[model samples]
Target chain A: MEPAEVEFLAEKEPVTVIPNFSLDKIYLIGGDLGPFNPGLPMEVPLWLAVNLKQRQKCRIVPPEWMDVEKLEEIREQERREDTFTPMPSPHYMELTKLLLNHASDNIPKADEIRTLVKDIWDTRLAKLRLSADRFVREQETYAKLDNLTLMEINTTAAFFTESLNHMYKLRTNLQPSEGAESQEY
Target chain B: MADELELFEQGSDAGSDEVLLTPAELIHQLEEAWLNEKFAPDLLESKSEIVECVIEQLSHMEENLQRAKKGDLKVSIHRMEIDRIRYVLSSYLRSRLLKIEKFFPHVVEKEKLRAKEDPSALSPEEFAFAKEYLENTEMFLKNVTLKHMPPNLQSIDLLKSVPQPNLDSFVFLRVKERQENILIEPETDEQREYTVDLEEGSQHLIRYKTIAPLVTSGAVQLI
Candidate 1:
């Protein structure tokens, strides 16, 4: 999957926005969205929030997990664990990038949050690579990857799966008779 | 009122499979189908009903928006939503077309072999497209390349020449339904096969062949 597509999914996530202008409730196909009152915080999708922010009509309230201290704790937990750690949000990385890139002024200490997210991402990716290597070395057919997020998986899914397919092809060729049917792609 | 709405929905293909999903649920299904089609190695069963409903919904909303005053915030937001849905819908259809082009012969063969009662893997339009594509490719080969070959080599078996989908290819999936005692096939001789219970909401890396049925059944989602 494209990184942009991952970001697209992240855009569906709801974020609180304080609209500066009041408006009536609008009926949308997916659902309805607020009868806005000035200064009242209302929940809208991240895409709408970003657009409203761009138009200077609202202020984006950063998601609670975007805090500097909480992320540091998650980063520590990630480094200390041998297995994948659960993320605050499944699209945490993509959400952080989107919010910071488009509405940085709305978020406090954007630089620190950005650096912290990168650290957690790097740590998770390194762990993912190590486990992938072990999985290949062991010739294992199944792996439980409960804590891994879509963006992290997408980064390695194509390359990892192709190499495994090649390895499977080579292994079956050596045996010749047993797995003959599956050998052909 | 609810009964009347349900009766109205029953007139369309959308009501045939399952209960009527709200417009929101229809959008969500389209996105899910988009991602599934994007990741799976082969063409999946067609979602033409959902596709049609979404298009209808979008056009209906679009016509309503047209009469509204310009520069309205609601109008713009609706337009953005429309564009987003259009993107996913087109991407889903485009990926199916790409797979159709790559494995046209096999796809056509499968369509032929399917029982009359089963839902077609290709929608009516797609089936026509595939047939036309197959015919055009064969004609191009015969006219441009095959005619020049020796008499015995004149014919080409597309089913043999074209590669089949690697059904055994590894795919990443998230289980939506808890399944007990699913067997795992070992990659090599040394490892013994074992069964694992797929707990709901857990993710796994496994062979596509093992979970293809699960994918079709909507018990697991290909990530």
Candidate 2:
């Protein structure tokens, strides 16, 4: 993929950074990164923030969506809506996993964030199971999923494939004689 | 040849006993293979036999098509199914080839630099196919970086600098074995050796790069 595409994926995924030292604006190929001030939080791409955090140059402020209360609200909204609710980022799961893994100490209430993320994931997956059941019952070839993160899509796709295979097996067993004849041919 | 035929027959018995795989079955197998490759890239070596079998079946189907068109045989096969199988097979192979190309960028670069002197560095089959994949990827990378990116960033080598999102990134994993004397770098710049003695069910957030060997060995799994 192009750098622009990569940047587009990263653009909306903001991580808060608290630099230890003051610095003038640092230029990057895509754009200027910062005119960083000591002890002040600034939002930057997850990648840049993680890089700086790994180097002990900055501490990461978890994204707003990482808040437990906010996630609970979003989860409720998702449950109520017949359609997928708007997500903060298409790559939210991945970004959250990356940030939490790399900068858990830097985050406020890290354990709470982790629990909430897990709770939300479990709820979403339960809903996905329901939808997948319906999809298989109806023998739908495609589904339009809304508000699903990339990780959820991967999980759902695997489930869908399994369901499809099961249905194919059922269809085969329903006509044992025809199946035998077809096999001979 | 008889053993190969018997294997094909057994696969056919699961669906229809046609000389070649039905489109649905082919697609299903392809999807399974794709997923297997995605989750366990090392298992790809084992899958080569399956891929070869599919290719052989496809050639047999092609010959059947020719005979049916000449009115010398009566075979029942959908043209659209053949087309679909071809499309899926090519796409599956292409995606895997791209990943292989990306994973070994240094090797690919070296092969390019020494193309004339050591054209046989890659196996004959790999050299023929990977040469094209490498060239296409190179051109795509160049266009993206040199033209689409800002002039200052044109010289930035993306593959070398950019962290691969899924591959080199941090992952939450559950330990499955009592690993000893493993070295890891934490948030601090110091490298530490820790015996990963976490209870079997305990999970930790680790850089996938640090635990890749363990992952392959089934000592840890991405959770």
TM-scores across all candidates?
0.94, 0.40
| Clash counts for the predictions, in order | 0, 2
lDDT of 1: 0.88
Q: Where is model 1 more than 4 Å wrong at Cα?
A: A174-185, B1-18
Q: In model 2, what is the error at residue B96, expressed in angstroms?
A: 5.5
lDDT for every model? 0.88, 0.55
Per-residue CA lDDT of model 2 for B1-223, tens digit only, reads 1122322322312342435544334445554455434543221322343466667767766765776555221122134335545655675576566555654454455556764532223444555666666567668767755578777866644345422223323444556676655545432234233443444645554445666667644565443
Q: Write the per-residue lDDT of candidate 1 for residues A1-185, one digit (tens) a residue.
A: 88889889888999999999999997877788999999999999899999999999999999999999999999999999999999999999988998999899989999999999999999999999999999998999999999999999999999999999899888777453333443132
Candidate 1 per-residue C-alpha lDDT over B50-149 given as tens digits, one digit per residue, 9 for 90 to 100? 8888888888888999999998888999899999999999999999999999889999999999988676889999999999999999998889888999
- Each candidate's DockQ: 0.53, 0.01
Q: Of the candidates shown, which would achieve the greatest DockQ relative to the real structure? A: 1
For model 2, the stretches where C-alpha displacement exceeds 4 angstroms are A1-12, A22-31, A79-83, A162-185, B1-127, B130-223
In angstroms, give how far residue A32 of model 2 lies from its true place: 3.7
Candidate 1, clashing residue pairs?
none
